[model samples]
Target: MRIVAIANQKGGVGKTTTAVNLGAALAELGRRVLIIDLDPQANATSSFGLQGVEDISLYEPLLGGALVTEKIFPTQREGLFIVPADLDLAGAEVEIARMPNHLTRLAETLKPLQEDETFDFVFLDCPPSLGILMSNALAAADELLTPIQCEYFALEGLVKIVRLVEQVRDSGANKRLELAGIVMTMFDGRTNLSEQVVAEVRQHFGERVYETVIPRSVRLSEAPSFGKSILEYAPSGAAAQAYRALAREFIQRHSPPAARALEAPEQ
Candidate 1:
């Protein structure tokens, strides 16, 4: 299974939105997808229409308090699943501060699940910070997908994340982690600023930037309030189409062999 962490140390960049809707879109394509909400805010959890913090979450599992598989929960989607988060997860950094190999705890916790082979994709929605939680997500992830909002500060945040990824790798916290792709979110085709940001990001990241840019749409923002993804809430809308396209691109980029096979022949 491929583990992709949707991460950025900036808020309102559409990280959770990408995780929820993109993950749902992948499931729509018949992939067994698991979304682990690593953010303490649990935005991804509520986006999936689930509530309650309960005794199970990645917090407890990675900290050695509970079994990782025990915390796994099925969502409404047939093949999509989630390991929801809780407010208590915010305290994990302080609690596990001095624990040995704290940075690797999450990676170790996820080893068994990755080996299970039941899931084709695992999306970890990281919080908007470079704290231990984000570190854990990095440690657990095979690839990092950063969503850059179409705004003035977009590149600033992107640079920080690129640096952090370098730091993490250099520190031996997550040597195998590599950037899968960069997604441009909240793209406003009508705005010159948005166009500029997209161009800058593409120039910096080159082919790593996804061609499917998520447009700014009210429907995308409003879906989470109703506890649904754009795929479920407004499947025919622009936001849904954009997310579906993003998911397809993501799958193709990560699963090139499958993509090549599908393109191979009418034999």
Candidate 2:
């Protein structure tokens, strides 16, 4: 299984949106997917119609209170699941900081799933901050998938997050950590600025950036408000098709480690 942290410290960059929609799209393609909403905003949780949830979050798990599996809640989708987040998680950073192996606490908590192979992919929907929660998410992830908006400042923010990922790798907490991919979102086909930003990102990251650019779709933005993914909300829309394409491309790029290991020649 692949543990991917869908993170971008800058808000409104479609980070959580990618996590939610991508998880749904992957599940639609017969992959077992789980999204751990690490944001206090709980946008991911509410995006799936799970509201006013209590004691069913990762707050207890990260603090040594309960196992993460116990907090796992199934969404309406068959193969998709979620570990919801609430306001309590905002306060968890302080308490988590005082704990032993704070950075790896999330990793340690998630070790069981890594062993059980419970899901094909576990996407961490991180908050827009550089706090303990974000640190723990990076430390626990096998790879980081950041969603960059198609805007003027996207490149600068991408550099910062890439540098942070490098730091997380060098820390030895998760030496396997790498930048999995960069997803371009909020793309306006009518704007030259959008094309320019995508060009600049591809210039720097080359093949690390995804080819499927998520366009600025009103239906995509409205899906979350109604507690649904783009696929469920407007499956035939351009946004939904884009995410589905992304899921296909993602599967091609991020094959399970065991599969990759099997493919590696004896050396």
What TM-score would each prediction reach against the true structure?
0.95, 0.95
Position 242, candidate 2: lDDT: 98
Q: Evaluated with lDDT, which candidate comes out highest?
A: 2
Q: Give the TM-score of candidate 2.
A: 0.95
Span of ten consecutive residues with least summed lDDT in model 2:
255-264
- Give a tens-digit lDDT track for model 1, residues 1-267: 988889998887899999999999999998899999988889999887787857668888778878788988988888889999998888887666778888888888888887778999889899998888888889878999998889997878878888888888999988988887899999998989999999998898899999999999999989988888898899999999998998788777776697768865678
* Model 2, C-alpha of 184: deviation from truth (Å): 0.3
Model 1: per-residue Cα lDDT at residue 75? 85
- Residue-level lDDT tens digits of model 2 in 193-215: 99999999999999999999999
